[model samples]
Structure formats: C-alpha cells, structure tokens
Target chain A: MYGWIWRHLPGNVYVRILISTVLVVGVVFLLFQYVFPWAEPMLPFNDVTVDGAAEPLGTPRAGGAA
Target chain B: MALRALVRTLSETCITIGLVIVLFVVYLLYWTGLRAAHASDDEIARLHKQWAQGPTGSAPAHEGTAGGTRDSGHDGGTTGGADELAGDGGAGDADSTAPGHRAGESFAVMYIPRFGGDWSKPVLENTATATLRRGLGHYTGTADPGDKGNFAVAGHRRTYGDPFKDFPRLRPGDPVVVNDGDTWYTYTITARPYRTLPGDTGVLKAVPEPVDEAATPFRRSGRYLTLTTCDPEWGSSHRLIAWGRLDATRPTAEGKPDALTREGR
Candidate 1:
C-alpha cells in the first residue's frame, strides 16, 4: 500500500518526499482530531458512567437496569 | 528475488502498524491530556468572566422569579442566618439567578484540597465523553450544588487531564469545595472511595445507596456530593465512588471557607 502511494506520487524524488511528509502529517492530524475521538467512546478505557450500553464487565444483561 | 521483495514489504507494513499503535497510545495518554488541559482552562476562564459580569448581563426575566423562590427555600434551611445575611446583602440574588447551564457548559469550579491547594477543575453540565474531556462532568438531573440532594460529578481516572486521578486517595473527612461564582459549598467526605460495577447507578441518587453498601451509609435525604471515576487506574471495568455531604456554605463575599484555609488536614 505504501509502495503504491509512493509510486503514484506526482513529483521528483525531493518533491515526492516533501509531498509524502505533508500527506503523512495530514493523515495523523485527521486520525487524532476526528477518527480517534469518534472511536474513543467505543473503547472501554474512558468509560466512567454507569449506563447500560457502556457496561464492559460482560455482554450487557437482558433487561439490565440503567 | 520475488520472495525477498515480498518479505521486505511485509516487514515494512508491520513496522508501520506498530509505530501507529504506539502513536495512538501516546495520543490517548499524553496528547489528550494536553488538549483537555487547554479546554478546561478556557472553560474555567470563561465561567469566571461570566460571573464577574454579574447576573443582569445574562439572566433572563423568568430567572428572577426562580431566584426568589430558591432564596426563600434556602432561608428555611437550618443555616437560615447565613442565607438571610446573603439575601440581605443581595449576593444571593445573582447566585440564585445564575443562568441554567447548558449541555457542555461549565458552571462550577471544584477544589479538592486533598489533591492539592491548586487542584481545581471546572465542572461542566453533562457526562458525555466530549464534555468529560474538558473537565469533571456534573451528572445531569442530579441536585445542584448546595441543594438538598446528590450533586454528583464524574471524571476520568486515567486520561483527558485525569481530573480525578487521585480519586482513590480521598478519605473520609477530606473536603471537596466548589465555587459557583457566588457561594463556596464545602462537602466533607463521608466515606473512602467505594468500588462497584458500572451498572450501579444508585450511587448517584438523592440519597445514595450503592449496590455495594457504602462504608458510611447515608440514612437521610440531604445535600450530598458524589465523585465517580474509572477504577484500576488504567482500566474501566469498574467505578470508584467517593461520597460527601454538604458541610457548610458561605457566600464568596465572605471569603474562602475554613475547609480550604485550615492546614494539616
């Protein structure tokens, strides 16, 4: 996948390096700012509330009280 | 030659994946804390600015009526003398009419001297992940500060500034003081941190009765404060709760409460 991206980049070797650096930074920014925050609630690390949907001990029980 | 090239590519991919996983962990543990610190600072600053401007600038007409009724109700409390003095000075007017906090809006600043003299966090309106990232979150539908019910709040134990990172250190008789621009509400810890499953919402009730009995069980409805957080430091499989009761309330005009000023507690 990375090889394909490198090969398809439209630039000389130096320019390609610069472009790839920018693209990498952009990808990391998007992942940190959007993807990770959106995905965080799905993970159990930060779950502090005692609500039904976020119970991590086991599969949420049937008719479990919130 | 083909096999060698494929092996090189596969190794490169694996290394990239590993680096990304490491980066994500750093983001979770460090970067989020940085961002949350900035957010919490801004929220607290905003709250202070709003409070300094006084009630006329923000409160609606209907809120005046609400303030009147609330003041009357507070006057009937056992601590009626102070409430009456606050009312007479007109300090309670702005406090009672303080605008109802909207979702994600910060309305209070909490100080846990047990954490440190400088340990303070803005208490926002809701407990959503986004809101908790900024500071401690006031559990919606619970009692307001100084009110006659549980004024519950939740914070992260690990990341996003870890406002309650020292949650387990809280012991009975420690003080958790809150400032809502006009009054300082001091709550005395009634029990050590209680451990329970995430499904036990009873710990946030007006008169809390956690599924696991609290070390100091509350027997009556009264002004209470509950602080909750994820347990095990880095895990969220359980919740740790600390309960407190309103020990005293003084108008901010009266200066810092004794719970905050006394040393060597």
Candidate 2:
C-alpha cells in the first residue's frame, strides 16, 4: 500500500513545494503554538530562591496566593 | 498547449508577486501602528513633562526596569548575560540614558550598569507578543504593575541573540525601574541567585521559604519584580532567577526617583 501511494504521488515541482511548505508550517504551528504552549506550567516561568549553604531544594509554587 | 501553459505560468507569477506585495504592505501597516502607539502625542508629552520635572533632568532613561530600555530608538538587538556585555568591551553605553520608549506604549527600558551596555524593554505581558524578540516576557499569571504577588518576567538568554543580554549583571541593591505613563515603579534587588528549569514550577511560587524563623514582612508582599533569563547563558539549560521588591515609586512628574529611598542593607 505504501509503495503504491508513493509511486502515484504527484511528481510536479510546484505541487511538491506547496505540499512540503504546508506540512512544515503545520508541524511548526502545532509544536510551538499549541503543543508546547499548552504544556507550559501555570506561571510556567518564575524566579527561584536557592540557599547555597543549606543546600536544600527550594519551596514549591503557591498557586494564586495573595 | 505551450501558449496556454505560458499564460498559466504568467498568472501564477502575478499572483505570487501580488501576495508578496500584500504581505509587505501588511508588515508596513503593523510597523506604523506600533510606532504610532509608542509615539502618541499625549504619551510623549506626559513622558516629557515627567522627565522635565524629574532629577534625571533628561527624559526618563529608556532602559528603565527589567534589563534593557523599551524606547523604540534602537533596532531590537540585545546581548545575554554579563559576560556578553563585558565582552562587547564597553560598547553597550551608546544610548544608555536616552529615551528609548516611544510615547503611548506601556513599556519601559531596563538597563543594569553591571550588564555593560545593551538595554531591554520590559513590556506588559499582554503586549509582549510583538515584543518578545525585543526583550523579556511578562508572565500573565502574575500581579499587575503595582498590585501584589510576583510580577514575573522571562527572557531568552542564548537564542535570538540574548535579548535579556545583561540580566546576569543584576545583584542585590540594584534598581529595576518600570515606567508606565506617568508612573515610574522602582524595584530594589533582593535575595541571592537561584536556578530552575525552563518550565520550572518553583520559580514563580508565591513566596520563598523562610530562611530564618523571624516573621516575614507582609507590607512588601505581593509587589515584586522578577528577572528570568536562560541559565548557563551559552546553553539552553536551566533559567537564572533574580528577585527584587518594590522599594519606592516616584512619578516622572515628581523629581528624581529618590536614590535614598532605594538604599538597601
């Protein structure tokens, strides 16, 4: 099935270029705009406080604390 | 058949050119809109009047708060970390004190003297989409300009040419200023260095664990200025975090941002 589909695929340069561009753009949009963004944690990035002497791991996030 | 093919090819070429022209015009419109927004007459007047009254004597420094200036003066190029700035061999001072922010925009330039030369604009989180390549990212989850909680910001350190360029220069006692219209919010550097992952959960936590048993000061709660940039400046590894508290606020209409008020222990 795969061999047959590949053989039948359009060999035209313009068609190939257009299809490739669309695929590349779609992948990028999905990864950067939707997937990566959706996965970012709440307050995805914030400042950290590390105590060197104690060598203890810092505290966790305080969701919406006033 | 050949003639027909030629006509079709010509039509396709025309369409491509037309699309390119359309995109070019749209980009021009976007640029104009940004400039107008930044240079609105009222905004310019307010800044000018404020600067005239302030001790800086000149217009409020464009590099106001986070790390670089927000002024529309320079093309949005920034260096990351102290070494990059220092490596510039003293080239970062070109427009250090100049008015970088245009007029109408709610943005300010941030400059760290220790960061050498490049300055960046810490823009409102909402407006950061267009300005991300220029400087820091304002976290929407955080507090407003002066409300409370951590007013967090993130910027790239390695990629896109290090727009947070001088974030590493930040140390305890340095001033981080944010100018919005007439208000100039100043933040005093506090705490020591901390590290976290790119999406580290610990970075934006509401409050830091107490170092000592002493009671914490609530008055300084909520209001904060956070600086975040790529860690290991050369690599895309963890992030470097710097925290500052609201020390004092002075309007451009008021004289200088009182240096004494920002004096740290």
The DockQ scores of all candidates, in the order shown, are 0.29, 0.03
A1-66 per-residue lDDT for model 2 (tens digits): 323333565868677667667865775556544543333222222222121211122212222211
lDDT of 1 by residue, B1-265 (tens): 9998899899999998897788788888899899999998998899888888885232342222222223224322333333333332222223322236677788889999988888889998777777888998877666668765678888888888878888899999999999877667888998889999888888877778788663545887666788888878877789998999887766666778887888424
Measured with C-alpha atoms, the lDDT of residue B51 in candidate 1 is: 82
Give the lDDT of residue B111 in candidate 1. 91
Best by TM-score: 1
Candidate 2 per-residue lDDT, tens place, B34-57, comes to 543343333335545654564433
What lDDT does candidate 2 reach at residue B175? 70
> Backbone clashes in each candidate structure, one number apiece?
0, 28
lDDT of 2 at B221: 34
DockQ of prediction 2: 0.03
Tell me the spans in candidate 1 whose CA falls farther than 4 Å from its real position.
A1-13, A52-66, B56-99, B214-216, B263-265
